[model samples]
Every structure is written in C-alpha cells, then in structure tokens.
Target: MTESLDDTALDRLFRTARTRNGWTDRPVAEALLRQVYDLAKMGPTSANVSPARFVFVASAAAKARLAPHLSNTNRPKALAAPVCAIVAFDLDFAQRIPELFPNNPGAQAWFADPKVAEVTAFRNGSLQGAYLMLAARALGLDCGPMSGFSQSGLDAEFFAGTSWRSNFLCSLGYGSDENLFPRNPRLAFEDACRVL
Candidate 1:
C-alpha cells in the first residue's frame, strides 16, 4: 500500500504554497521544465487521452507574441515571469488512443463524436494543467495560473493550423514573497465535501 505524504510534502504541495503574482529574476532552466512535464504526465487521465500541450514562452520574442492576447492584469506578470506557459488542449487527441491505450483498441471510438471529444479533452486537459502546476511547485518553482486571456487570439497566433487550442496560461518562476498578497481562505472540508 502507498503511504500518505508527510506534513512537509503536503505543505510544500498545498497547505502553504501560494500563487505567484510576481517573480524574482531567477531563470527556469529547460531541463527543469522537462522534469516538470515528466512528473505531471504520470498523473492519470480518462483512457489516458492526455490532451494537454504546453508552450513555454521563455524568449522575449515568444513572450511578445503572447502579451497582446493577455488581459491587462496578466500582461505585466506574463512579461515579468521567466516563463509563461500556454496550457493548451488538443481537439483531436483521440487519434492517439490506439497508441496510448493499445489494450483497448475500441476506446478510440468513444470520443468519435465531437461533443464527447470536447468534454473529455477539456476535462482531462484541465486536470493535466493542475498536475503541471503541482509538479512545478514540487520542483521548487512557483506558479501564477490565469484564465483571463483572449483564447481565440492565443490559439490563432500560437497554435495556428494545429489541433491544439488554448485552455489557460501559467507563469512559472521563483516567486518574490514580497509580491504575495495575503493568503485567501478556502472552504472547510465539511463545506466543500461529503462522506456519503
């Protein structure tokens, strides 16, 4: 049986972790980015559909391409961040099911309908994005995840002619604690969950 994570691990991953609003000048190395993805990819998804794609905007030219599409509030953070990742989803991810789930060749047929594909891609993709954030934090990086952006423009500029579409944006770097706001309260377990 698997053991529960210790207090320090829990705190590092959730209890005391804060969303980054700004970052220090420290850079996020490419190797670390690869490591982050390697860990996050292991997180489970329905039928292993694994639709999420990420674009690490580490260069000024790439960040410039993304800036105009972000909301005013997100623009400065995106610019200030060492890397702004575009967390996207593939609208045609089901095509890979035969490879990812070879034991169940019939699984690909489940998402043949556009509606089912949409829902499954979205649901699994969003989960992958969350896993990415957790993996980043575990690797000692910080994250600022945002959804206030022009999705169409991002998709048009960054994912043009590709099946990938924007889901959200995440800025990654070493956070400046001086830039953090007061921690917000979360719903109590009883208020947000149930044993039944």
Candidate 2:
C-alpha cells in the first residue's frame, strides 16, 4: 500500500473516471460487492465513528422498490444498472464507540448531543460513500453516483423503523459510452484552493 500507483491505476481511480449515465448488460456479482465494502470500511472517520450503511439493490425486485423514489431523469439510469447502492448514515452510530474507539472510553458520550451526532454521522458517512466509489473503481467497476432522489421516500421504503437515513444513491456496473457528453471543465487549483 505504500508504493505509488502506476498511471493506469491513477486514471482508473480518478483522472479518467467518468460519472456514468449508462451501463452495459454485464452484471456485478455479490462477492465483488462485498469486496468493495471491505475495502471502503478501511477509510478513517472522526473518532472512528463509522456511520455509513449500504444497501446494495441488486435484484430486480429491490430496484423496483427503489425506482419510484428516484427523479425521472435518474430512474432509468438506476433501473438499467446491475446494482444500486443506497448509501446511508446511522444516527445511532455513537453506540458503537466502545468497539470502534476502544482507547477513548468517553467517545460515545462525546456525541451525546443530538446535533453533534447528526453532523458527525452525516460528515463521516459522506466520506465513507466517496471511499466506496473509489474502492469500486479500484476493483475495475464503474460508478454513477447521483443525488436526484427523494430522500424521504427512499428512507420510508428502505430504512423505516431503522436508524439509517439515505445520503445518496450510486449505480454500479460496466458503463456504456453511449450518450457520454464531453468532459466538463474543472476549477484550477488556484481558483479552488488556498495557500494559507
């Protein structure tokens, strides 16, 4: 892990990785999904508060459960993919502090306040979501992460009676080049960063 990655690996992970809008007929296996989660869970979080939870909607029935909550533009993208992951955060994540941060006996109490828990969960969970995408890419998978979905509807359909709340949705599979638009411009480092 200490070695620098080759150009090919870097391009696959970031440089040339596009936000897929379409997928091929190829399927993503369950074992590969487990590998993605195993790699992603290694990403660090505040106080080791690993709040993210994922639901890999791989079956047609499961996708059907998720489709109605997606925006019209996103519905087809998700339905066509081999798998759609519901990236979520658990509001009650602090309860696992004893296990995740064994050295900090009071770690759980640190997030005792509802507001603190909510913020920490959301921030760290979002980081985990990004890590998931990169992990998938590292394993030669394509990603199409989208925010165009009904949060409340998704939560009700998938997370009701649970502490989990949807953060975003990402479809995964072999991407198709069909309908791919030209690469968009990105802000230069000088414009997006600071030297302070």
Cα lDDT listed for each candidate: 0.93, 0.95
**Worst 10 contiguous positions by lDDT, candidate 1:** 177-186
Q: Write candidate 2's Cα lDDT for 32-108 as tens digits.
A: 99999999999999988999999999998998899899999999998999999999999999999999899995889
Residue-level error in angstroms, candidate 2, position 105? 3.0
Q: Output the lDDT of residue 156, model 2.
A: 98
The digit string of per-residue lDDT tens for model 1 on 41-72 reads: 99999989999999999999998899899999
Off by over 4 Å in 1: none
Q: What is the lDDT of residue 194 in candidate 2?
A: 97
Model 1, CA-based lDDT: 0.93
Q: Clash pairs of candidate 1?
A: none
TM-score of each: 0.97, 0.97
Worst 10 residues of 2 by lDDT: 174-183
